[model samples]
Target chain A: MELDFSIEGGDFTQAGQASSRVKKVLKQLGVDAKCIKSIVIALYEAEVNVVAHAYKGQIHIQIDKDKIQTLITDEGPGIPDIAMAMTEGFSTASKKVREMGFGAGMGLPNIKKNTDELKIDSVVGQSTTVSMVNYF
Target chain B: MKVSEIIDQLGLKVIAGEKGLDREISGAYVSDLLSDVMGNAREGQIWITLQVHQNVMAIASLKDLAAVILVKDLEANANTIQHSNEEQIPILSSSLSTFDIAGKLHALLADK
Candidate 1:
């Protein structure tokens, strides 16, 4: 199965919609509870990242018998230092974003911990793409 | 224990999603950070925080949380209450601070 979703920057109200839908689909497919939890967590963090930082983004998901794959691409101020951004407690979010209890710099780390494979590509002034996969 | 039991014991005011008052509560997590709650909170746990935005409801629904407790008498945004009602996950209120409410909730759950 395949799925796609669009994410709008600064739209905090709609941030987790994709994650919630994917979760329901995974549940109906009889995915293991642990696997579903990890997938949902990673996808949600990535979705929120787009809403928080990017100008706009798209998410593509592919589910096969053995694994689930996700690609999140965003157009915005891409990460200048992916390594630094992955570190805990590092963030560049504005004051307003921080006041809403986000931008704590745990987003990427959480995605990494929950996914079996993860890749991040960015063009500092243009766009970023995050690809992640988890085996069933 | 059920959500209604905690509401009765803690004197939490039900702000919305009264339909979920019978939902089961496995535990409680106290945090104002959205990502922290998302990364560490487990399913069936009641979230206690001061965040009043609709994003809080988004996280609560995605996490399959039992309910949300807004501490310090903070009122949720209009859209937040709307989402709570839509998802059927109760939005509860308490005048107590996060620290006080968390402590009380901890004691209450420990006895269960």
Candidate 2:
């Protein structure tokens, strides 16, 4: 099954809606709690990344008997260096955003750590797409 | 220790999830990095951080944490509280800095 939720940039209200829904689905599917936790963390991190960095976007979540995948594509000022952005403690968010306890440069890295697979594609003026999957 | 005593000893407020305050916390982590928190936080630990976001509650839930405390007078808004409630995690706000909360919590639990 699949679930999709639009995460509005600068809108903290809807920040974890997608992850919450996914968590519920995994529980109902009888997925292991440990695996469910991993998916929740990775999806939550990626969702926060889109909300904190992008110009507003949607998270596409797909779940099956084997694994869970979260594809986050955003239309915003794309990241120039995926390598740099993946580094811990590297961030480009504004001071106000930083005050909210995000943009510490851990978003991408966290997604990478929790998921079994991670892929990224981006451009400076166009958009960014982040794909991650966690296997059961 | 009950949540009431922790609140009394530390001068903290239960922003939401009142049902969970009485729950005990085993170990608490002090980090603003959400990534570190995802793997490091264990069950029943009070996550003491200066960060405030809806995702924080999500991370705490994944860790099976007992509660989340925003140190140094940071505010955890309505949505954050509501999310914590749904996750069955107590969302707490403390005027004490992260350092102080860590120290106090450590001292209080060290003997036990």
Candidate 3:
């Protein structure tokens, strides 16, 4: 099965909607509890990155018999330094965003730690795409 | 311990998600940073923090936390309450600071 979701930038009000929906689907499909948690965390952090930095984004999810894959593509201020952004404590979030307790620079790392595979593609001044997979 | 028991013992105010008062708790994690909680907090743990936002509920739901205790009399936003209700994860409020709440919760869970 496949699912699609759209995320809006700077919209903290609905930040977790996509992740929440995906979680429900996973639960109904009888995915393992532990695997569901990891998938949810990774998907959520990816969703938040779009809401926090992108202009807008689309999330594509594919659920197979053995694994789940997600690709989050966002049109935004593309990350200039993917390596730096992956660092645990480096962030480019605005002051207002930081005050909300996000932008702690832990999003990507958390995603990487939870997911079995992670790939990030970005071009400065254009967009960023994050792909992640978690095996059931 | 159960969430309701914690409320009675700690004098916590149920701000929202009262339906989850019976949820079982196994541990406690204290952090104001959302990602830190996402990365480290375990299932069935009560999160004690000063963060009073909607994303707190998001993390609690995604991580399957027992409940959330907002310290120092902090209150959650409207959206946060809505999500809490939807997710059925209690959002408790405490007049005590984070340190005080964490200590009490730690001692309680330790005894368990």
Worst 10 residues of 3 chain B by lDDT: B103-112
Put down candidate 3 lDDT per residue, A85-110, tens digits, no spaces.
Answer: 99998999888889988999999999
Scored by lDDT, model 2 comes in at 0.79
Across B48-104, the per-residue lDDT of candidate 3 in tens digits comes to 988888999988998899999999888799989999999999999999988888888
Top lDDT hit: 1
Per-candidate iRMS values, in order, are: 0.7, 2.4, 0.9
Q: Assess every candidate by TM-score.
A: 0.98, 0.86, 0.97
Once superposed on the true structure, which residue ranges of model 3 sit more than 4 Å away at CA? none
**Pairs clashing within candidate 1:** none
Give a tens-digit lDDT track for model 2, residues B11-106.
788887787777776867888877678756777788888877777887787677878888878888677788878776788888888888989877
Q: Give candidates' CA RMSD values in order.
A: 0.8, 2.5, 1.1
Q: For each candidate, how many residue pairs have backbone atoms clashing (under 3 Å)? A: 0, 0, 0
Candidates sorted on lDDT, descending: 1, 3, 2
Q: Could you give candidate 1's per-residue lDDT for residues B1-20 as a string of tens digits?
A: 99999988899999999998
- Compared with the true structure, all predictions reach lDDT values of 0.94, 0.79, 0.91
With a 3 Å backbone cut-off (N, CA, C), the pairs that clash in candidate 2 are none
**Model 1 chain B: lowest-lDDT 10 consecutive positions:** B2-11
